[model samples]
Target: MNKKQWQGWGPDEQAEQHYLVQPRALAGGGDVRHVSAFLRASGWRDKSKKDGPLLMESPDRTVRVAYDPCILPGGWTIHGRAGDATVEWSAHLGRQTPVEIVAGLTDALTRPRSAHAPNVWAPLQEQNWHTRFADQNYTATSPDGAAWMQYRQDADGAAMWWTGAKDEQGNGWTAHFTPNTPMHLVQAFSTELAGPDPVMRPRGRVPHSAQIRTWSVSVKPSQLSAWQQARITAARAATWARTSARSTRPRTTARPYNPAGGARTRH
Candidate 1:
């Protein structure tokens, strides 16, 4: 829909418009819209209005996920807070970061975790990334060193951090899980980071353009996961229902229409 038409649309219709667009993917990953939808399904409440940052927060408001396309480098930031409120963890996903990758971290937050902490580095190590210790911190680097993860413990606290550089200038994405953030959640993010599948992004929006392979065609709705497709269906229904209701309202109203405002007059 054009800007004017979209502005006149109700939230449901506006959302359907987004769902209907077959977004192109870059080598880094899927659309952030999928991540937004995932958070909503996981009990997060949408706090932003239409066409603004996709901001959502947990029931307790301890966790938040914000996606703003206008943001440079990183367009998505997911955060969580610990009990005292002094410590919070965050993941800044670059615009090209795949939806599945971000969803991996968010999905982990919603599930129950065992007492034991999963090996945060195991996933990357298995992918043949190099690992080493330096200055009391454990660090792992991708074969090319462009991507790295580190775990540091100091007098202050322990934290996990990861960064993927898109260029030598250091423009890219970063994630930091501060002390008290669950290790399982970090591990889940690492696992998705290590997946062998190539993420999709639109050709024009890709970061580290020269470093990854390109696809001639964008991903179609048919290629989306069952969960994603289901969300699209729901959005479609919402938009249709709104349209249907509006169309029937005029016929059902007994009062004469007020031409000045298009409102109905009381009998």
Candidate 2:
């Protein structure tokens, strides 16, 4: 479809678009942890015509992962299909899955011809994605080599909210860490086609990743620090400006009832 046509399409139309992103790390097996993945998928399907991308990244966006060179998340357990599969996933947020599941999934997936990696992690969007029992802090690294987002839900089915291309600052945002980019998380995203859901769940002691991807890199250290500072300043300013704006804004009051004269009067 043309750019205009793509932009004008509705949610259902967009949903019909199937995007498959099989971004996997081709690391030789031997207990390797650190990994990265860039998932890009997009497609369109007719209503009720079960058409989905082979590698689905939440709805219509991509994500990244950074690992801490530890357990390669050798576990994966998928319950339901994408968008509703969260029974055991929510419970396992931020924590390593049991050793048994991990070993099983990895073995099955890594077999030649059956080589698969359990990337089925919870909502990486964090903001838009919904789930049951939301947690304020949860992060996971997928076997796909990307880390998950810090969502606000936990064990129960939550909600998904998708904010379009515009940022709250009214500035156009093309990447994460933009300060106002809405988190486009999937309540129960698609399943991990490979096998076990090798994701660490919430309450995990391991350090969580800053779910943001680096779109641009600076060769000079000075430039990098400046970039970081700009973002930090923007974030802080956004917070304070929002708070101050709210504090100064006048709230609308309900019109007073006039029972005696039956005439509405403004107080």
Candidate 3:
């Protein structure tokens, strides 16, 4: 579609149009704001400098989220540390990976810990992805064969769990979660990736383009889906609440929020 047509299309129409042609074309940078807003609402602080990578830290200062658009690959980084500060865990979302999917990771991060161990492979299974098991390793492949999640029980470091996605032309990206990274976070990303929901993106903004294939469709903004509408509303409300709380706080720029008496350092 032309610029005018693309600009006039609503969220749902854009999503439908994209999904019709390239179902794997996720809305990469589109949901970064939503992710940041959610983090702020969850009591994370924006510690980034002007025009630099957006750096946000959890209230307890044990976790940090970084989004650096200038980086070519692996621009999104989430790191968490143990209480003793000797061990660290991390997840990296490549620049081409959808921010919508990354938001799932952040959501899982802030959620209250569950008593039962999470089944990271369940989401893909629910979506009907083909799952294969080996001695101690498992791999889940998407229904369309465009994406995959692999787990190596015997491996350590980044190879423990890997997620990858590709377009029709073979252009692709991958995300890595360290061995020590929480399993729920991986499950959250798996759920988002496997879910049938479409991530909206303008034609040319898609992360990777097929060599010879092109597609576009347009519709009114009123066609937005109910779930997307609710998400937008909730994100905006959370942002407003966080901003209001910040504005009403006492003006003590010298000292930051630290409920614990010790120094709060980023991992």
Q: lDDT per model, in order? A: 0.65, 0.27, 0.73
Quick one: best lDDT, which candidate?
A: 3
**What residue runs in model 3 are displaced by over 4 Å at the alpha carbon?**
1-29, 83-86, 153-159, 207-267
Root-mean-square deviation of candidate 1: 14.3
Per-prediction TM-score to the true structure, in the order listed? 0.64, 0.23, 0.69
Model 1: residue 55 alpha-carbon error in angstroms = 1.3
Q: Estimate, for each residue in 59-145, the C-alpha lDDT of model 2 and write its tens digit.
A: 222221221223343222211122334211111111132222223322222112223332323333232233233354344333333
Residue-level lDDT tens digits of model 3 in 178-206: 87787777888888878776666655565
RMSD of every prediction: 14.3, 22.7, 9.8
- Per-residue alpha-carbon lDDT of model 1 for 113-164, expressed as tens digits? 7678688899999989899998778888777556677887776665556544
Q: For this target, which candidate reaches the highest TM-score against the unseen true structure?
A: 3
Worst 10 residues of 1 by lDDT: 16-25
Global Cα lDDT for candidate 1: 0.65
Give the runs in model 1 whose Cα sits over 4 Å from its true position: 1-30, 69-74, 83-88, 94-96, 153-160, 168-171, 215-221, 224-227, 230-267
TM-score of 1: 0.64
